[model samples]
Target: MTEGLLTAKAVMERLSQSGQRVVTAESCTGGLVSALLVHHAGASDCVEGAFVTYSNQLKHSALDVRDETLARFGAVSAETVTEMAEGALRAAARATVAVSVSGIAGPGGGSDEKPVGLVWFGLAVNGKKTKAVSQNFEGSRTEIRWQAALYALQLIAGYDE
Candidate 1:
C-alpha cells in the first residue's frame, strides 16, 4: 500500500481501538485528508466527517472561524488552524478529535513570508489542549497536498487520547 493509505489505516485502527472518532477541516489540502481516511474500509466507525472549507467565507460560516482571527493571522496561520480544529470538533458531535490543515500548496499565490508548500496543521482532542505545527514542504502542488494529508493522519494516529 502507499504511505498515505498505510497511515490512514493506522489512524483508523488507532481510533477504533481508542473508541474515538475524527473530523477534518481542510483548506489548501481540500478534502484530501478526509478522502484518505475514507479510503480505508469501515471508515465510518472512525471518521465522524470532514469540512472542506476552502474559502475564508466558508471557514467562517461552516467551521465558525472568526473573521478577526483570519484577518489578523491569515487563513494559513497557526491561530486559524487551531480554531479550525477546535471548531471541527465542536461541530461534529460524535468526533473526539479533529485535524485541521491549511497551506500554500501552489505554483503561485505565495509571498516571501509564506512561501509555497508552507502548511500549518492543528490537532484538537477532547479534554486536551489543542496544538498547531507548521511544515515547509518542497514539491508540486499535488505532492504538497498529499504530504499534508499524510501528516494529518499521523497526527490522529499519534494522539495519546
Candidate 2:
C-alpha cells in the first residue's frame, strides 16, 4: 500500500468501528480509491465496492447519473457528482455512505471555465443530505490524480469540510 492507501486504511478502520460501509465511484482517478480501500486488512468491514465510470455513458449506466444532468452540468460538475453519490448509495445495497469523484486530469482538454486539475467530489451518508465540493490542484496528471485520490480518502475519513 502507498501513502494514500495508508490513509485509506485508517479511514477504513474508523468506518469499521462505526459500523459504516462505503461505496466509491471514480472517474479521472480510475479505481484508485477502491484499490486503496481494499488494500488493507478488514476491508470487507467498510468497503462495499467501487464503480470506475471513466466515460459519461458508464457514469449514467452504472452510477445512474442522468443524461440530462450530465448534459446540463457536465461530468465534472457538482450537480453530476451529487447525483452520482446518491446513485451509488442506492447501488451498493450494504453501504450507508458513498463518495464520488469526477475531474479532468490531462495535458489537454481543459477550458477556462473548468481547467485541468479541477475536481468535484460528492459525499452522501444514507438518510442525510448529499454534499458536493469542487477543488483545483496544481500538478502533472499523475500528481493531480494522487491529490484527488487522497482527498477522497480524507473525505471518507471526515477530515475534510
Candidate 3:
C-alpha cells in the first residue's frame, strides 16, 4: 500500500484505540481524504462519515460555511476551511475529531492570490479546538490531491490537541 494509505490506517488504529471517531469534509481534493481513510480494513470502527462539498454553494449549504467567509476569504481560505471542519463536527456529534480540506487543484482556476496546488486544511477536535494549515503542493491535479490527502492523514496521526 502507499505511504498515504498506510498513514491513514495507522491513524484509524490509534483513534479506534482511543475510542474516538473521525469525519471528513472535503472540497478541492473531492473525496480523496475520505477514500483513503476508508481504504483500510476496520475503518468503519473509527470513520464516522464524509461530506464532499466541491462547490462554494455546497460548502455553504451542506457544511454551513458562512457565505461571508467564501466572499471575503474565498473557498480556500483558513476561515472557510475552519468552518468546514466545524460543520463536520456539528454534523457528526459522535465524532471526536474532524478534518476539512479546500483548495485550487488544477492547471486552471488559479490566480495570483490562490495558485493551483494551493490547499487549506482544517482540524477540529472536541471542545471545538481547531487549527488551519496551508500547503502549496507541486504537481498535476491528481498528484496535488493525493499529497493533500496524505498530509491531512499525517496531521491526524500526530495530533495531540
Q: Which is the leading candidate under TM-score?
A: 1
TM-scores for every predicted model: 0.97, 0.96, 0.96
Provide the global lDDT of candidate 1 against the true structure.
Answer: 0.93
lDDT of 3 by residue, 1-161 (tens): 38888888889999999988999999987888888889988998999999999989999998899999999999989999999999999999888888999998898999998999999999998885699999999999999989999988877776665
Which is the leading candidate under lDDT?
A: 1
Once model 1 is optimally superposed onto the true structure by TM-score, how far is the C-alpha of residue 110 displaced, in angstroms? 1.0
Which residue ranges in model 2 land beyond 4 Å of their true spot? 159-161
TM-score of 3: 0.96
Candidate 2's residue-wise lDDT over 43-76, tens digit each? 9888999999999999999989999999998999
Q: Which residue pairs clash in candidate 2? A: none
Cα deviation of 2 in candidate 3 (Å)?
1.0
Model 1: CA > 4 A from native: none
lDDT at 99, model 3: 91
